[model samples]
Target: MINILKGMKDRHSDDVKKYDFIMDTAKKIFSKYNFEKIITPILEETELFRRSVGDETDVVSKEMYDFIDKGGRSVTMRPEGTAGVVRAYLEAGFHKADPIVKWYYNGPMYRYEAPQKGRYREFHQVGTEVFGIRNPYLDAEIIKMGCDFLEELGIKDLTVELNSLGNVESRKRYINDLKDFMAQRFDKLSEDSKRRYEKNPLRALDSKDKGDQEQFKDAPKLYDYLDEESREYFEEMKKYLEIMGISYKENPKLVRGLDYYSDTVFEIKSDKLGAQSTVLAGGRYDRLLEIMGKVKIPGIGFAAGMERIAMLMDDSLIKEEKKGVYIIYFNETKEYFIKIADIMRQNNIKINFDYNPKSFNAQIKKANKINVEYVIILGEEEKDENIVTLKNFITGEQKKYSVDEVVNIIK
Candidate 1:
């Protein structure tokens, strides 16, 4: 027998309920921010990530699932959401038609990597992006929206770590100094950090290696290298964040694991998330569009790992949907019960009936297993009279009621 694939999960019962709660709460908050929903294809050209996410990044270099399709087109299951959204924006002529747009997406992202606890090969994310807007207030607003989204989900103890990546020139200067510093102890760096040192030295700061992190202690801080314009931009973003009551701390080494990010970058970390503590993270990608298609469009956005958020969410906080009604019937009245169950369903009631007519006690045992609020009894007597006995699971009270009465009472 074939078993379920590794790193894949089937969400059912409470798991599905929790997933629904997360998405519903996301829609509620995203709509409040006036961010329209955009659904992009799960599959896109593999070149999209190579261009936008960067060739040296782990997401592109190590984890992306790309292949030549049946049609001989190189395609990939998206490893992240932002790149696809940008592709959609350009392809739909939104660049010329609607230059500025606030859009959010909910979808699954695939990565070919070892899965653990909150991290999965196939994970879901709810993210938002604002295009063609570079205002500092909007930066703070986006971070606040992330905080509000988590707060709405009852996941607390969040730390907002803010930083600046500077522009192309400022970053180039910092990268040169960083590469020189890391080269002195190249052998001590982790294999991943060593690979990143030459092509993308900034990612070394985000390294999890103990030795790499130790080497960073005396390294040049990215904040110190920010040019005048980038410095002012970071300061303005901090000021607005303070005014908006979103407490944050500066992390000079908070360069994210992507090649496109520039200017202000921030991550909202939660203590409860263990080592993988960042519950949500995003940064300004002022040069990404320029890099992708040579069209300048400044954008900032954040993506929350739905699985990670669910990991931090309190079980009680995610309200489980209450079970409705279960119908039990005898063998002789199977057809009668199905029609009655259909009638109940048509009346906007959630009803489930035993398909194979079972003993009265046996059916009630099944109903009890489901923990339904009520059960409809359709034995020979009830079937003959065109009436049924409704037993309230909670109250343990039984009463005879007509089909219409049953609908009204359940409704």
Candidate 2:
């Protein structure tokens, strides 16, 4: 028999509950900030990612699930969200339509990589992107909304880490200097780090190797190489976060795993996830549109791992939602039970019932196995009288009520 593959999971029971909670909480918070939902196709031309996300980054070079389709066109399952959103923006001519736009999206993202813990080959993300603004205050507002999103999910103990890549000129100078420093300890670098250094040297700075890190101690900090303009941009963004009461720490080595990011970049991390602690991360990518569509626009956004957030959520903090009513039919025919259920449902009461007729004791046993709080019994007298025997499992009480009366009580 065929079986489920590795790095994939079937979400049910409490896992489904957690996903539902994450989406509902996300929509409410994103709506408050005037962000509209946008969904792009799961597959796009392979060149889209290679151009926007970069050809050298691990996402494109190693992780993407890409292939030549039937039409002999190279198509790829989306590895991330930003590239698709930017493509849709340009394809739809949104740059000419709206002066400023706020959009959010939630969907599964594909990658071909080893999975660990909450990380998966087929994972999901809920994220937002804002266009046509470059103000540092706007940057802080996005961070504030992100924090509120996490807090709404009952996640706590998050640390906000900030860094700046500056513009192309500033970022370039740092990369050149960093390459020079990394070249000295070429022999000490890990195999993977050594491979990354050839094309994308910035990724080597993010190495987890102890020996590589030891040699990195004296390496020049990216912040030290930022030009005066870049310095002011980073400082102003930090000041805004401070004024908004959003605490942050400067991580001079925090260059995210993306090439489009520029100027201010930040990550929201939680120690609860152990080694892979970052739950949400984003940065300013002013030239993304320009690179893909040759349109000059400023945009900033962040994507939070849905699985990671769900794993970190404290169930106690998010109160269990009130469940619907359950019906246990004891009559030969479920005619009365069906009628009562419809009436209760029409009145906005959630209703559940046994499809097969069962004995009085048997039906009650089934009801006890589930989480339904209120159970209705359709025995002889109640079925004949067109009434329901409503039993309050919590209070240990029972009463006979007409169809209308049951609706009123349940509602």
Candidate 3:
């Protein structure tokens, strides 16, 4: 037999059902916040990601699945959601559509990372983006929306880690100070951290390497270097969060792994996910639109991995048991069964037809397997009498009814 790809797995029916449930629930919650749905192509120009996600980041430098297409154009499978959204926003002139445009999207993202628990090379994300507004209250609402989503999934023990990377000037000063700090401990740094230190030193703070983490222990905090304007912005964001009763912890080391992010950055962590604990994360990227499209539109958004959210989901939170009718018919009664099935369907009643010409016992067992509430049995005798037998699997009651009566009962 041919083998499946190392990083991809075929999802079974149950897994697909769970994925649908998660997507549906997320859409409902996002709709309540007035976010319209938008979907972008999975394949995009490779430069879009390199320019937007940043060439210095791992997503662009290491994880991106990029190749030259037949047209000799550099194309890539998107590794994240925000870049594509911004591209669409600029292409469609959405900046002129509304002063504040809010949109949500859910789809597969491709990356070439080593697959681990709750992480994959091909993963799905449900994300939201708000453009044109830089209000702190909107930031607080976005954070609350994330919390609301996790709560709806019944995920427990979530911690919100918040931080401010400050403005460009403050961040630049902090990065220089951090580089000087890391320079002394350079010999103790990991190989990957060393490369990051040379290219994007701020990203070294986000390193998972044990030795590099220790080296960053004495690094200067970005908050301390924040100028008065940036400090006030961070304080105002926290004030809005407090007003909304959203609790968060300040993590000085929480500079998100993206270069576009500025001011507020946050990660919603769940203890249940172990080492890959961040379930949802994003922050303000006020200059991303300007950098990408030469159009200034401040934006803030977050993306949550569907796989990670599904891992922490409680089965009880998703009601998967569907109530419906199953039809069990013998060969001779096929015509009558089909007619009844049509009538039930037209009435908006859920019906499952068992077309096999098997024994009554075998057919009824199949019906039980599906756990349907009602099973309609049609045999030669019932067909001749223009009636059908209805069995209430829940109550173990059996009765004969006219075709109209059966339709009414099923309805």
TM-score of 1: 0.94
* Tens-digit lDDT string for candidate 3 (1-411): 999887877787767877888888888888899999998999999999988988888888889999999999999999999999999999989887775899999999999999987688999999999999988888889999998888888887778899998888888888888888888888898888788777888878988888777878878999999999889888998998898888889989898656678899999998875664899998999989989998888999999999888888886777766668988898888888888788888888898866566898988888899899999888899889988899999999999999789878776
Q: lDDT of each model, Cα atoms only?
A: 0.87, 0.85, 0.87
User: Model 2 — which ten-residue stretch has the worst lDDT?
Assistant: 329-338
Q: List the residue pairs that clash in candidate 2.
A: none
On residues 213-285, what C-alpha lDDT tens digit does candidate 1 reach at each position?
A: 8978888998888899989988998999999898999988889656568888999999885664899999899
Evaluated at residue 300, the lDDT of candidate 2 is 97
Error of 1 at 25 (Å): 1.1
For model 1, the superposed segments whose C-alpha errors exceed 4 Å read: 257-259, 274-276
Give TM-scores for every candidate, taking all chains together and pairing residue i with residue i.
Answer: 0.94, 0.95, 0.96
Ranking by TM-score: 3, 2, 1
User: Candidate 1 clashing pairs?
Assistant: none
In terms of lDDT, the poorest run of 10 residues in model 1 is 314-323
RMSD of 1: 1.9
Rank candidates by lDDT, best first. 1, 3, 2
